[model samples]
Target: MIQRRLPIASASLLGLAAALSACASGNDLPSADTAASQVTTIGVNSYLWRASLEAVSFAPLLQADSAGGVIVTDWFANPENPAERVKLTVSILDQDLRADALRVAASRQVSQGGGWVDAPVQAATVQKLEDIILTKARELRRQAIAS
Candidate 1:
């Protein structure tokens, strides 16, 4: 009886895995391509980014190049200290707004230091949008820092 159950159990497990993969892999996206290439950073949307991610922990996302200077990292924070226990949805978008390497975004983050905060995140869209916002934010930040 156990031997016979193995095949049925295996089949059930396989089906469940397939269904999950489809959803988790983002295969059902409307388009893998979006307005990513044209994103230009004007300013940082840090607050919005944080809010978006607090609601949804998303899969990995990406972007291309930008025409601005600085990039932004969005992370959710505890109301007490917004930046304290924050979960950052980091982006590897350069001042140029390009995010080619998928892993690069994860490697670089505002959360490098130890903390009790989880890696704050939103859907991949938060990351994609950050590239757009950061191109400009980076430039502004650079200019401000220089001043």
Candidate 2:
């Protein structure tokens, strides 16, 4: 099974992205380009799964997926490095079809050990996660606008 979250999930970041609709409020969308305009950056958060000091950047966020969520799992340089185990789950919410909207009100991570995604990810894994996240962001953006 795959973990689900919108914006950015995975224990690597202290803060990911979540929004009801990219809006500061429940009825307004943030600058359409705000998310996409922003450079795609990733960092570990203070969650139970603390990743090393490795950082990465890919694409920007640009979507409002209310159905599916984006997930990023992280691990230490050493695949089995217990010290580098970290994972998080992010959820995306699509409530309305208007400009009015609210970004993710809260964020959460499902910390556990199972599969690769269920567990922590390595550097290469990070790249894959980043790509998925960026794509999701853009898809959501288009869907939001269409709504």
The candidate that achieves the highest TM-score relative to the unseen native structure: 2
Q: Per-residue lDDT for 5 in model 2?
A: 56
Question: Cα deviation in Å at residue 81, candidate 1?
Answer: 9.2
Q: Candidate 2, residues 2-81: lDDT per residue as tens digits? A: 55553244643433334433554566744454323222222211110111111212212333122243333232233454
Estimate the Cα RMSD of every predicted model relative to the unseen true structure. Answer: 18.8, 23.3
- TM-score of model 1 vs. true structure: 0.21
Lowest summed-lDDT stretch of 10 residues in model 2?
45-54
* lDDT of candidate 1 at residue 135, scale 0 to 100: 52
lDDT of 2 at 85: 38
Per-prediction backbone clash count = 13, 30
- Candidate 1, residue 136: the lDDT equals 50
